[model samples]
Target chain A: MKFNHACKLILKNLFLIFILTSGVHGNENVNDKVKKLTLELRCMTCQNQSIYDSDADFSIDIKKLVKQKFHEGKTESEIKKFLVERYGEYILFRPLINFKNLFLWLFPFTILAIVTVFLIFSARKK
Target chain B: MKRIIVISPLIILFIICLFTLFYIIGNKDPNKPPSALLNKNLPSFTSKSLFDNEIILTDNDLRNKKIIINFFASWCTPCKVEHPLFFELAEQYPDLYILGFNHKDAAKDAKNYLKDEGNPYTFVGVDKDGLIALDFGVFGLPETFLINEKGKIVYKYMGPLTDKIIKDEIQPRL
Candidate 1:
């Protein structure tokens, strides 16, 4: 009976150690994920600074919230969508490629295509 | 093909000029970025009252009433500029529910500021760490939101309310 009690206590300690070490490693990855996600977020209080770059209270709170959301198993796009929904598209420095922004994204390429077509015709004429 | 090429540049220039004129004539103010929460349901929150810690106010309590949510801080000078307007608003619209959020200010300081200025709010909720403001997407202090009876955030104004704004923009909504 005495030996069985000691073995049970030993198993509990081993389980606790496993959880503690795993939690520490999980936290390291969580920080890295938080950094990457926050770099994409604008600090609403400071207005042009990235959340990762600003030391403002608003930025700090956002960083914590992002970290918490990541821990809650939210994906990067999910987090971005959530922030965009709350703060609007102005918060995203890199605009999404939606139908509204499709024109914005394709404009330069369209200009280049037009220029290329014009140049090819002019060269053929010469 | 040669004529098409010659006309394409003119077409491009015309489109550019058209968009530029549209932007200019649209009267878009660069200073004010439009609020995302417009026409959206109010974000839920349960906050302790500034005057009484035991007293709590939640999003549900605001339903079926026209609410004016004003985020203010004692440290914000612009909030001070719009301070007296709340009093006038309360008087004119007795049925309107004015929910004041004491945002990020020390509790004592918020109390003192309200005491000095006179509390025009129906209920003052303390947003001590600014989490509530974050949920509301409050970019800065002195941001005001008008909620309709259904608890949808119908309009949001991000600056001090002038008498002109109150008369023209706000009174009509009320």
Candidate 2:
């Protein structure tokens, strides 16, 4: 009877440890997702820092909002679209690829291509 | 060939200089981000009145009238500086509807602030939770939006409402 009691206590301790460890891991996963999403969002109040980096009240509010939306099972794209609709494209650190911003997206590559072609033609001429 | 290359570079330099000059002179206050809601209809929201808890104000109340929506807080110093100007404007334009949104402020503080400063608002709404402010895309306090009779947002001023702003920008539009 004594041996049986000791085994039961040991098993209960192991079960509690396992549950605690698994709960911590689960929380870490959600925290990682929240951090990734917050990093992508600009702090509108600061205008210079990401929502994850800024300590502004507005940034805190935005972080809470992002986490709340995630809790509601919103996809990342859906969350981004919602913020974009409210705050406009200016809220995005990386400007959206669209008709108005097509040139902005393509301009650097276009310039690089032009420079490369010009250099190639010049080398051939030499 | 050498002359063409030299001349072309200089021409390009001059053109770049001209463009930079035009850009700098034409665009004043480059720090001010353009409001996304300009020309868009006001976002609908319902909030309790600051004065009377039973009274709720909505977007419907703002329609069919030339309205000025001012986002303010008791804690913001700029709002205090701009308070007298609002009172002056309120006195001047009795027909104009000015809605005061007490953003992210305590109800007691907001009421006390208004009492101290003299309430110039036609209808004051308390944005206690700031959800309404978020809907309006308000990043900071003391921003003002002018809505037309059609309920379209015509102009948004991001800073304090100075006398010059009232005389030049707002009065002309009104």
Candidate 3:
């Protein structure tokens, strides 16, 4: 009897957590989501302008695309992936953290680790 | 131990300097980065032909045949510079299909431009809203693509095509 109650409680808590997290994600206005995603995308026509900031034809089209994707119930990452596939990595301001770009992402941390090790070694010597 | 420690960062810096120098020395134009769609399949598209009111062109029409797709606008001045070259391309390779996409251009203006320039394209499609260019990841006006029999985009050029480019870059591929 006790085990059955415990199992029921765990299932109920899990369901609640899932609902809360999904609600938070879904409650954001579609326009706000579009703005946030477009901020990360580059305006291909204009030099050094994010899609959200640029009034270029390319930016406007991307904004329309993102809005459409959101309306189709696509997630942010899904939309980003679609954009990356369509336009290549140049369309993104932030490079993706994949095997090809793993070195780029970890290079700063590698430097930090080396500096820390060198500092510790010198301190010990002193 | 102290010498080795001091030399390590110097070694790393020297390696970095060498790589950076090699990259800078390579003939990479700062203005033009490489197109990302090289060797990729052309995006499937459908459009109404500029010449005919009822004719529609789709990706299926491009199957088992090599086609050169050129995106141009009547309003773009640079397109006029490359305008004459298509006639040459059409003349040289009679079997090769040349497609013209009149991007974001009015039907009347495109018809007038073609009439004035002497139409060389096998088919002219109307991309009235620039959506087709967006699909191709076109950065600016007057982009050209060479699609192979496999429907892969083998070569892409941004800006106007010159006689030299046609001889050196495009002819050898054909």
The number of the candidate with the highest lDDT is: 1
All candidates' lDDT scores? 0.89, 0.85, 0.86
TM-score of 3: 0.84
How much is the TM-score of the A chain of model 1?
0.81
Instruction: Say which docking band candidate 3 falls in.
Output: acceptable
| Per-residue accuracy of model 3 over B21-134 as CA lDDT, tens digit each | 787568875446577788999899999988786999999988988899999988989999998999999999998899999998889998999888788899999999887887
lDDT, model 2, position B9 = 45
Query: What is the TM-score of chain A, computed separately for every candidate?
Result: 0.81, 0.79, 0.73
> Tens-digit lDDT track for model 2 on A28-124?
8767888998888888778579999999998888888888888788878888888887777767788887898886677567657656766676687
- Displacement of the residue A117 alpha carbon in candidate 3, Å: 3.0
Per-residue lDDT for A75-108 in model 1, tens only? 9999888888878887887989899888778877
Q: Arrange candidates by lDDT, descending.
A: 1, 3, 2
Best by DockQ: 1
**How far in Å is the alpha carbon of B154 misplaced in model 2?**
1.0
Runs of candidate 3 exceeding 4 Å displacement: A1-28, A122-126, B1-5, B17-31
Better of 2 and 3 by lDDT: 3
Calculate DockQ per candidate and list them: 0.46, 0.36, 0.28
Candidate with more favorable, higher lDDT: 1 or 2: 1
Model 2 whole-model lDDT (C-alpha atoms): 0.85
lDDT per residue for candidate 3 within A19-117, as digits (tens), equals 998877665688899999999998877788899999987788889989989989999999998878767887889999899888768867876777787
